[model samples]
Target chain A: MHLSPMPSAIVATELSKTYDVKVRDPGIKGALAALARPRYRQVRAVDNVSFSIERGDAVAFLGPNGAGKTTTLKMLTGLLFPTAGKAQVAGYDPWSGGNPFRQRIAFVLGNKQQLLWDLPPEETFRLNRAIYGVSLADYTTRRAELVELLLLGDLIDKPVRQLSLGERMKCELAAALLHQPEVLFLDEPTLGLDLEAQQTIRTFLGEYRRRHGATILLTSHYMADVTALASRVLIINRGRLLYDGELSELVARIAPIKRIELVLSETVSRARLEEYGTVAHYAPPRATLEVPRETATAASTRLLTDLDVADLSIQDPPIEEVIRIAFGETEQDAEEDTVRTDVQRAPP
Target chain B: MTRFTRAMIVLRAFWQLNWLEELQYRGNFVASLLGTIFWLVMAMLTVSLFFRHTPQLGGWGYWDVVVLLGIFNALAGVVETVLRPGIGHLPTDVRSGALDLVLVRPVDAQFYVSFRRLDVWRLADVMLGLAVSGYAFVQTGRAISAWELLAFAVTFAVAIAVVYAIWVTLMSLAFWFVAVENMAALFDAVFEAARYPVSAYPGALRFLFVYLIPIAWTTTIPASALTGRLNPALATWAAAVGVAALGASRVLWRVALKRYTSAGG
Candidate 1:
């Protein structure tokens, strides 16, 4: 057997960015004092981190708010220079302003719009065609296909500001794809959209990846986007890459037990449920049970044979719960470390 | 394609898009034309009041001063048409993090940013200003020669170049002082001085406008070229000043961009 070199779309090694943030206290005097001799502080927006992503691979960047997710994305896109590290995308340094590298990628920032605010989406589409030097025939074909897939008919002709958020997002996604970029840096593509729009965008992205084989790195708060589009996820917290693995592997690592909910015809005692496994919750007519992942089937069988049950269903714990638990454990450890450091600085 | 050729393609696309978008607001063209005419009348009234007293303040006749005012309006049209809608949006773009979209483009950041959009309706002021200048030239009753025409074109380009450099210098400061979202107001305030000849001011004030702010080059030199008052020696100095202003602004832009850590997510 022969092994091939990794065909990665992105490679980052110990990439980091720190900011010199001006700290201001609340008051007129503080502002005046700031004008005189401003107090400055250092914020480690992204600490040392390293990761590589393969070509045509979709990865979800996950983190809590202000967890350096946006900062890391900005660094990778060459919007900000890293304090220490090297990053390469598509075999070129992104920060070097290499037009060839830039022409091969696209970024769709949800909070910041790229579409001409006063112009129709079609005009923007045409403008991008000229900038990216897309052939007329290719642009027309892609525009038609995207319009049909995204269900945009007359919507593309209307001014962008006239459209609703969901409609504008549909156009936004289409505009980013007009150039047919090889790598897409999508920051919350489905943000602030309705459930139906989110579902539509997710479906479109999944189908688009199939058609074009473009690598997508998306940061979205909606789990539906992550679970539907990306097979792998990167978890960052406090300027660190805490976990990088398959989505299923992450769930398995965090939760090794399956949640078994038992609806009883008659009242079930806690002691009776304890015979099976840990009883997460118990009530008069209902009992929430937890069983080991491997023995869920066997335990369900024994429970059905042993108890008078109205309904029994087994389910894995929700991904949201798993992540919350994971972040909680790490946050608590970080809190403890902070407390220790605070004590050391107290006397000095 | 060469980088310069590609930049031209992007610029052509921008103009077409601007035309299409402005077509939706057809009423604004008439409204803008009326507004420019109204301001022109007001400016003429102010000039007449000044001429009512002095035969020539700072050695310029009534029509000579009118030529400067026309040049001022034309320079203002250039500001409103191109620089305001384009580079004037820089501070807001920086604050809102919209510049991230620009930086990722295959185009040159500075060139694309400076000419991204045009206010088509405001271009009427440019034509109206030149018409006013031509109307004032007839009142000067001086024989206009081909040499003066060529000199007018050169000085007009220098005027535009200087105004562009001033706008770049002011707008780039937004990167350093992020709170200066209304920094363009400083330019408008200082540009009021260019409505008259620089010599109209006191010696110290004229020196400030000439060397420090360089607003004098924006209107005085162009108007003097058309009036045939620009000496051959001063024309050479005006050209040098235009180049120097442009070079200084470019240096300021590069320095200020280093402080841009871009706001918002």
Candidate 2:
């Protein structure tokens, strides 16, 4: 992973969290037995994982469910204390919350709202100004800028409960940024938004980053969100950091092949396409092939030269598929290695 | 600026914003005011029923209990206007992880959580309660001295402190027992006892009220001062209890917060 020389906005070392999970059985006898003495099992929610985020970098955190993505964000934002190790945000220890530190950071939870329920989003915006002590001049400037960019003309005046989910999320984002925070911790900011709203928010965040150069550590299940907004990615699985590097680099390393589709002027024989590459899909006048990255050029040339191919395109497989392949191999390795998923560092 | 001044600033901001939000719903003001007045009338009728049977309650005249009842209403007003709308949200915040917003602010979480919201109409309870107390005071035909008035003022401040402390202690328990979201109901149940003087209850119940839960300090002592029945030593004791309650609640809050497992954490 490439990191700028700027001082780190976030530093987490050996961070871990464990919970005492209630264990119950699935029968009347088990329930009666549990009533006599309730049982609990120690479940490690986050293992000893370490990483540093450089200032002004937008990094995506990706993981399957219960993979500790939210737990790590919680510890870094001072909402939860790690059972062990240390974390710092903007040079201030997050667990030891002080106004100066908190004032410099902004966190947005996708489903949760910071806006007043009965009041309009504008009220929440002003409340944030007061809480952060943002000056009147600065608040006005920031509010106008956010309103314009977010297209929040009458939206801010409408009560939060009356707004649509996409509108509410836009207001939530505006509420978060009114203080001009230096760092942002986003947890699935585009969780349930439609495709258009998702693109709008992704574009807005990209602009915000470019404008303020704020350090962003975003965790999202949406591949488009991560791909469009974050240049680097961190993948965690089962409370462990499995991969940390550029998104493209991880994809190249794990899924080293591309898919090619051809539109032929006439029907092409399956045998003819098989001679060039693995025919993944075949139809009367079109075909798709999976070719090795190094051999894709040769295969495309062979197809164009021999066949009446009218049009052709080459594309990488969906990022989700790439990640799935990478995760599958790791899980298999982990199962063989005694199911040890809590490795301290991700394998390069 | 000092932390206290900073809190004052934040409180001012919250108040201004809330007031504006409330302005949008003008009918809420009238509706809540009528509701409070109706409740006050019912309360007075209930007291009259008690007086109809006995000439006095626990050796105190009818008007004396009215004074106590007035003080009770006033304290309840403070809870409604400030403490309830502010710290009353703590349990839900803890459960929903909304406290994350409060915890991240640069301000003192305890102070911010306690004064961030206000039910503007509830302040009317304070005025009406004081009006009733003054009317009952005049009915006693006792010329209250300047010293007694000073004592009343001090004891009233202590009453607010005690009530605030009780709220803090109750809400802080959300950290440990997140599912008990209705802990404020426990406070309301116990506070019902404060509507009458501590001496009016049976011996065991009186002892429990005055010493165990200390509801006596919240309303009984302040009313006692207005009625010119306050023991100087007890007034001093009330002040001490108020300070102690505040200190204890602050300590308990810190300890309870250590158990906070934020949402998705």
Cα RMSD (angstroms) for every candidate in the order listed: 5.2, 6.0
lDDT of 2 at B244: 94
CA lDDT of each candidate? 0.84, 0.85
What stretches of model 1 exceed 4 Å from their correct place?
A: A1-7, A256-324, A327-331, A334-348
> Chain A alone, model 1, TM-score?
0.78
Model 2 chain B worst lDDT run, 10 consecutive residues: B174-183
Error of 2 at A207 (Å): 1.9
Instruction: Grade the docking of candidate 2.
Output: medium
Highest DockQ: which candidate?
Answer: 1
Expressed as tens digits, the lDDT of each residue in B18-69 for candidate 1 is 8988898889999989999999989989989998998996889999988888
lDDT by residue for model 2 (B1-265), tens: 6777767778888899779867877898888779878888898889889999999887779889888888888888999999988999898888888898788778888988888888888898998889999999899899988989999999999999988988898888888778655778889999998888887889999888777887888888998898878989988998999899899999999998887888656
Backbone clash pairs for candidate 1 read none
Residue-level lDDT tens digits of model 2 in A187-283: 9899899878898899999999999999999998877788899989998876788788898887677657777898999777898778888887898
